[model samples]
Target: MHSINIHNKSGHDQTFEVHGWANNQNITVKAGQTSKIPAPDGSSGAIIALHEGHEGEQVEITKNGYGGNDFFDVSNIVGAGGNITAMQVGDQSTLKGDPHFMQDMNAAWHKASQDTRNKLKGFVFTNGQGKVTRIGPIKDSPELEKLVRTFANGKAYVGVGAWNGNPGNPDDNAQSSAGHGNKDILITYNDGDASPDLASPKRESRVAAFEVQRVQVAAAPPAPPANGPGIILTNKSKQECTYFFYGNYWNGNGTAGANFDKPMKNVTLAAGAKSHIPLPTTFKGRVQRGTELPATWVEFQISASNDGAAHGDISLEQGCDGAATIASTDGTNRKNGFANDVLKDAPAAACAKKPNGTKAIATTVGNWAAGPNQAAIDYLKKVVGQKKAYIVGGTGTDDVASKNKCLAVDMY
Candidate 1:
């Protein structure tokens, strides 16, 4: 049999005799009181007696009264002494005081885990002074014996140390050096995995949580002030007339407009004709008149005639007589001569040949379909470059017949 004697510093003193073998037995003392238990000499067993419950009893103890603290002192009275394995005083009392054994163990574990996660990798849970706590992987415990064996075979082992008051400071003299001291454990991976070496427990938890986001960059639009020069032509003439306008651009190499052939319709002025002719929106699919063309020197020419026919015998030709000439030089208006001649002879070279592989030949001459002529088709095919052609006509012998005639000769 085993016994324990408890002396209260401020209250009563009592004794208890624990017979036979008892495990996890609880003994309690009242508030501000003390109790004791006696053990048979030469007996061996474990005893746990707090200041709240009796032998073989289990109860939750709470602190009461101000300046009222209880004390418990356990001593083994048996030779080959029965052990006084555990003693819990103020274990979980509500009074403002230091944490209990369990809480200390938990705190140690939390500190260890945080330190390991930040400074080291691959830590596991182990039993601390009272409960499961975080530490280096346990290789010696039965549950981890296999892992330990494996690590040993691989010349790797994880060492453990008793909890120090400061988990981060592994070198603190406050640590229990009797059991396992502060040391690192080398854990070997079963499948060639590497273990991480951690710094001292006193290290800060460096593992941080972060957020990631994606940002998009938008492209800026073109500036409007940088756009190029523009030209607007207004026809203020009476009597239906056909006008042809031409211009030469400074393409960095030299003047390059003699190759373009743009024909305007026979605008019927009807005494006072007024029409605006804007330059082509784009040149060669790139050079926009108002977006790319600079205000550099350029030559312009305009040709006008009262004859309604696009190309035929002209009884009289107005607006443009003599020959094509320059209307403007070096961004300045030049002396106006036979302006129509200047328009006609703006360029001495003939217009570049249409890229179409074939040319139209007048098959017959008579009242024909009133649709686009071969010239229009060739022009459209050369300029617009449509692979197929379609002709629409109104009800009339001359109109319907003109469709086929137009297809034979160059007529719009």
Candidate 2:
């Protein structure tokens, strides 16, 4: 009568033996159900679930949901169950095993569930001159035949509008060409019928059949680039960026020398530029932008490292505006697919902890991982007017031969 404190998470009506309460022998909590027990004198009790094979799940109950939990609703509670009742299940840990508390994690779940469950089944209809005609099948029906005749070129543009099922579809639009397995409605039209009197009923199947006997074609993977497997990095950023790639191949523990630790690799990228890098499947690295420490970077891996799914994480370890992306095709399938990116559909803080070492990457084949090709000017001004004077290098780029083009990253 006060608030629903005891809940039955079982599959049937569970009678719980009430203890430490007056004039109450048993409390029946329906399967996946909850109930309120009014304690006029303000009493407390424990309810032992009388469920088959589950007699051990005992729950404690109180007038006000105890232990700082608000199974009790104030002004802050929201939807479905709230509209059904006014109670709220704020912190469920207090009433941990209460079936009804936070039963629907999302408040709109109940209404959304009911709507999905009560969806209309498959129905067919014809619309001609602002009128919806036929309700069922089309064969031998004069109404549909007449509807088709009204349209121009004796051709009716069949737009299969509404298709509904329990969860299978309403997810995807009804496709133009039929036979995709979900729900297909193909409209066949003819000026004449297959009556017993006619020598032959003209049932013309639409679209070109075999245009094959004419010349057949089979589906194949996309054509690979003239160069071996590799990734194409495009610089779409307005500002010039210096990009770097360092492999994960570990050496002892040095930075620049032939010892270990120090790693570096980078190329200049003008505002709008593109570069393709041919790498090995054994290549594991980091692709980043900027010249100094703490620049924009993302962990990029687009090739099959596991011989299956290639994964790339948006390592916000260093930050990016989130537009950087690494996309590539499969070596085995030769199909263009799999794009790993930052910011676009990914959240900033979502991808935490990511890599790339310093300029030692040149001597180091791979340290962090890999970026693009564009002549981005170094931040250091080389003109004679400034204080720290240094001679400008003629051009910057190194040729590194790699086997098996395994990755590509796009930094925008």
> What do the candidate models score in CA lDDT, each in turn?
0.21, 0.30
In terms of lDDT, model 2 sits at: 0.30
Give model 2's TM-score versus the native structure.
0.26
Every model's Cα RMSD, please? Answer: 43.4, 28.7
Candidate 2: lDDT of 128? 54
lDDT of 1 by residue, 223-309 (tens): 231112222222222334344433321111111212122322222233234333333322210111111101001122121111110
**How much is the lDDT of residue 368 in candidate 1?**
10
TM-scores, one per candidate: 0.16, 0.26
